[model samples]
Target: MEFIILVASSFTKLLDPVVLAYVIAGFIIGTIFSAIPGLTATLALALLLPLTYSLDVTIALMACASIYMAGMCGGSITATTINIPGAPSSMMTALDGYPLQKQGKGALALGHAAIGSMAGGAIGAMLLIGLAPFIAEASLLVQTTGKFSLLAFAMVVIVIAQRGKVIKAAMAACIGLMLATIGLDAMEPVTRFTFGFSSLTAGIDLMPVIIGTFAISEILMQAGAAKEDRKMTEAMSAVKIRRRDFIPPLSSIREIGLACYIKSSLIGYSVGTLPGAGGSMGSFLAYVETVRTSPNPESYGKGNPKGIAASESANNAVCGGALVPMLTFGIPGDPITAIMLGVLVINGIQPGPQLMAGQADLIAPVLASLLFSAVVLIPLTLFLLGPYFIKIVSIRKDILYGSIALLAVVGSYVATYSTFQMMMALVLGVLAYYMRKNDFPVVTMLLGFILGPNLEEFLRRSLALSNGNPMTFFTSLDSLFFVILTLVFVYFLAIKKPLQKPTGAAQSA
Candidate 1:
């Protein structure tokens, strides 16, 4: 009953003009950031973090939550229209979405993506609200060893998921882990990778790496492509989309089916609840599962509406799922939530089990904002901005790429107010460009960088707790489960699955 009242009050708070205005503003800003290639929701949130220092805590939280939800949905807009995903999470969306655009079904693809995002976001929010307490309680059972094991499991799964590119993925992850060690040691005051620089002691910020690897690298790649082929303008102008074409047919809905949305959202929510497992992984896993279970699997990666639905639904759902660990355990599920954690700290609010007990008022409003944002996304994308989004693809390459490059540079520098960061971004951008050309998976590097510190800290802490006894990990049931799970994933993803290929071929022959 008390919970019911809190939820009701939370909804009422959304009616406040200040909160509503921020929510709307955040949604709009997030949409624009996510729609533009080389700009991401993470960059938007990072830029917005400093500004939050001057705002009311509740309003700030609401705005961040709204932006997170909107940004996840926004990525699909460009992914469908231009073949370039605005965010990493939408990479899977681009697989099917861009092909649909080539077929002049860009509007239909966007509509399906928006609808899927709405359903997934709503369902994920409900799950977050309902399961948070239980998940938090369960999380308490995990010790340092268990935590370390869990992060290891996530990393292993991510590496194995790259399939044929596993070696490159592993190398990229190793580079990220090495990069993460550049800052001060987690347990001691010693700075290992400073290399005699003041800025190095503070460590390489995630913002610069993120912007460099994704935004700057993307800009360089686009520039190179434009130089090689000047026909983009002619090609874009050939595809035409009408406002009336924006509405998805009922057949699409029926074909994708309600079950697929629910299943993909559940997958996203589950993945998001794990610390450091992010939306990109969630969406990729969900899309893979969708194709595996789909009766018409051949239709995937070929302008299939179900593919767009599955990818968008899973990625958007990750927003709510990601908050579970952040709110309940003070553990960020991804880089974006890590920034949100900073927001909480700046506002003198510590996130953990006690957050709900003592600060239900503030937490309630944030949760309400997530739900409201999801509800608003559908109408905003499909009705208000759908036609404009379709026209985005028709814009000249020079203007679009030029503007994005400027934004990426400005945004990276402003985050730290340091010229060093700008240089670092350019350096990483060049490195990423070469890596991309060589087929190395850059996303793995980012994931490794994000999770590496946590993994190292947890492992060191666990060993220290047990007096350096390696058996400590095996002693705990929770830790043992994850360690065993990691092995199973390796077997399925790296060994057994590969070994079965020749056997199957021989049998078929």
Candidate 2:
């Protein structure tokens, strides 16, 4: 009865106009922030974290939650209009969204994305409410050895998920791993890849490299295409999305909605609750599972509505899911959650069980506020912004290319103001271009680059705990499960028929 009163009171407080306005503002700002190149949800949240100092904790949490959800949805704008992904999570969307846009189905695709996003957010929020205790319990048991094993399994899955030649994928992972080794060794103080240059000590920032690889390479590739291919003559016309289009006649909203929401929510929560896994990992896994389970798996890279739906849904779901561990425990679940955690600490709201008990008033109101934001974003997205964004395809390519190049230079230099970093970005861009042309997946490389340092750090910690016993790594149930999972995946890959490159729609431009 006491808990019910607390929640009811919190829900009443969530109806305040001031709290409502701030959350709406966060949604708009996050949408625009993530729609642009070179800006990410983490950076956007971090920039706003200081401002939250003056506000109430409820307002601060509302701002963070709204921004996180809107940012995930905002990535679809670039994915559909420009063939570039504004966020890492949007990369999977590009597999079909861009293709559909080129085929003049941009408006239709955006509608699907919007609907999927709403469903996913609702599911994730519901899970937060209903399964919080269970998730918290699971998180507590994940030790260093378990984390390392999970990372290893993630790497293997990522490699297998690549679109092209297995050998090329392996090479890309190697490159990413090698890039990760450039800074100081994780356990030992000895520098490994730095060649005595002071700039090398800081190592390369991943975002600049990613921007150059995907954005800059797109520009270069476009420059080489025939002028006829570069033409943008298509008018931005509204495409009607009848109820029939989104919820197919054969698939009821009850069935499709439940499947998309549950699968995406679970994937998002499982991956998002993990210490370092983020929206991208969740989106990627959801997409792969959708493909594997779909009745027509071959339709994935085509203009398949279900494929687009799965990726969009899972990525947005990660926002609420990622927040669970961050608010309940003191640990950051993903990069965006890390920034949000910093904000909480700065506001003197230390998270964990003690904070939950001591600060129930504050925490309850914030969670209630978040559920309200989801309600607010739906109409705002469907009625207002959905129609306006389709016109982005009318923009000229030359101007677009020039603007992207400028942003790439500025974004890279902003990190350290080093000429060496700019030079490195260009070098990486060139390598990435060649790698793509030869059928290697850049995302596989990105996974390895992001995970390599953490993998080393965790391995060292686990070893130290075991007193140099290598076998101790597999002692944990979580570690053993992951090891077995990795082996099973590898065995499947070995026995699976050789990949036959499809000539038509599945081919990347």
Candidate 3:
């Protein structure tokens, strides 16, 4: 009862004018960032990370939560309006949404997307609140060998989950793991890989990497894509949408059915709990399941509201599920959560099994922000801004990306007041841009960097205890479970995935 009261009171704290203002502002910023192609919630968070240095930790967390939820749902705006998905997860949404736009039902499709986001987001947040403590407790039971196997599992899953690009992903992960070794040794006082620079003593700051990978690289990518988006900007000038039409009708809701929403949310949450799955996978799986089970499966890519519902719901719910590993085990489930972990770390919070028990007050408001943003903000933003979607899409690329680049460079400097780190950000950005051009998954690299320390630490400890015995992993039950689990994931996510027939959206795409 006390815990419940604490959470409820923590939620009520969002009603404070200052906190509420930050949440609303963050949501709007995140929505705009994600609504524009190539810009993402991750980018928004990366750019704003320096600001978190001055803000209260709870406020920063709440804002991040709102931003994440908004990013997931806001992509539907462009997907429904322009046939171009603003986010990768919204690719499935565009298949049906663009058709609906042609039929003059685009606003309604966006409405359906909003409703689905609300349902999935709310349910996912509630599930996180209910299940995190138990998971955290369970996490504590895992010994060192189990921890190593789990990190190994996460790394392998992330690499293989790249679908057909396993080799490239592995290469990126290896690079990330290598980069992680540049700092002081985790155990001893000596630094092995510093390459003889005084600046190497402290290692690379996370801010530089994040700003470079998502923010600076995005700017570099968008600088070249401006011409491609020009036609879409001109297209937006000819299109107009009515705000009132953004509200779904009772008949449409009845058609989509509550069961579909519930199932999709559950699927999203389940997928979110898996390392490397992220929102796109959650949306794809939910949408595929919905199509498989629907009575009129053929209607999905033909402007079906159910398709919008499945995609938006699953993607938005990913925010809640993705946070589990970040909060409990200090392992990021996705890139955004990896950045979010950076935020928590900047605020002096070290996430572990004990974090929940120790800092429920700070955590509750963050979860509440996730719930509130989905339940209230998604629809509110739609109803208020739906009619002006064209205006947003029509913003000049030069001004938008120019501002982002400035912020990225400045934020990199702000991290430690070092020009070297800012230069590092630019260098990393160039690296990320080229990697992305070649279809390398930068996310796996980021995950590998984030998880590398613990992975190495756990492995060395386990090996040291076992007198360098390689079979110790197999001898330990917990370690064996994950070893088998990794094989299971390899078979399914890697081997079995390629043989399956493409879904309705995948086929159409």
Per-candidate Cα lDDT values, in order, are: 0.78, 0.66, 0.86
TM-score of 1: 0.78
| Order of candidate numbers by lDDT, starting with the best | 3, 1, 2
Strongest candidate by TM-score: 3
Summed backbone clashes in each candidate are: 0, 0, 0
Measured with C-alpha atoms, the lDDT of residue 186 in candidate 3 is 88
TM-score of each: 0.78, 0.63, 0.97
lDDT for 52 in candidate 2 is: 63
Residue 377: error of model 3 in Å? 0.8
Name the lDDT value of residue 293 in candidate 2: 84
RMSD of each: 5.3, 7.1, 1.5
Ranking by TM-score: 3, 1, 2
lDDT of 3 by residue, 1-509 (tens): 44456666787888799999999999998888888877788899999999999999999999999999998988888888888788887878887888999998888888899999999999899888888877887888888999999899989988988888899999999988988888798898988688798897877778888899998888888777645556777767767788877888898899899999999999999889888898888888899888889888888888888988998889988888988887787788888888888888888898766787788888888888888899999889889877876697578777887788889999999878889999999988999999999999998888888888889999999999999997989999989999999999999887774534336566545
Error of 2 at 67 (Å): 7.2
lDDT of 1: 0.78
User: In model 3, which runs have C-alpha deviations exceeding 4 angstroms?
Assistant: 1-4, 226-228, 499-504, 507-509
- Which scores better on TM-score, 2 or 3? 3
Report the C-alpha lDDT of model 1 over 1-509, residue by residue, as the tens digit. Answer: 45436755798887888878899889877887787666677767766665676799889988999899988888887777767677778878888888888887888888888888998898898788777656666766777789888778878876786778989989988988898999789889999878898888877777678777777887787777635333444544555657787778898799889999999999988877765557877888788888889888778888888888888889989988989878876656676776677678657786655676678778778887888888775557567877766456445557766776777777667656888988888888888888888998787787787778878988999999999998988998989999999898788767874522212112211
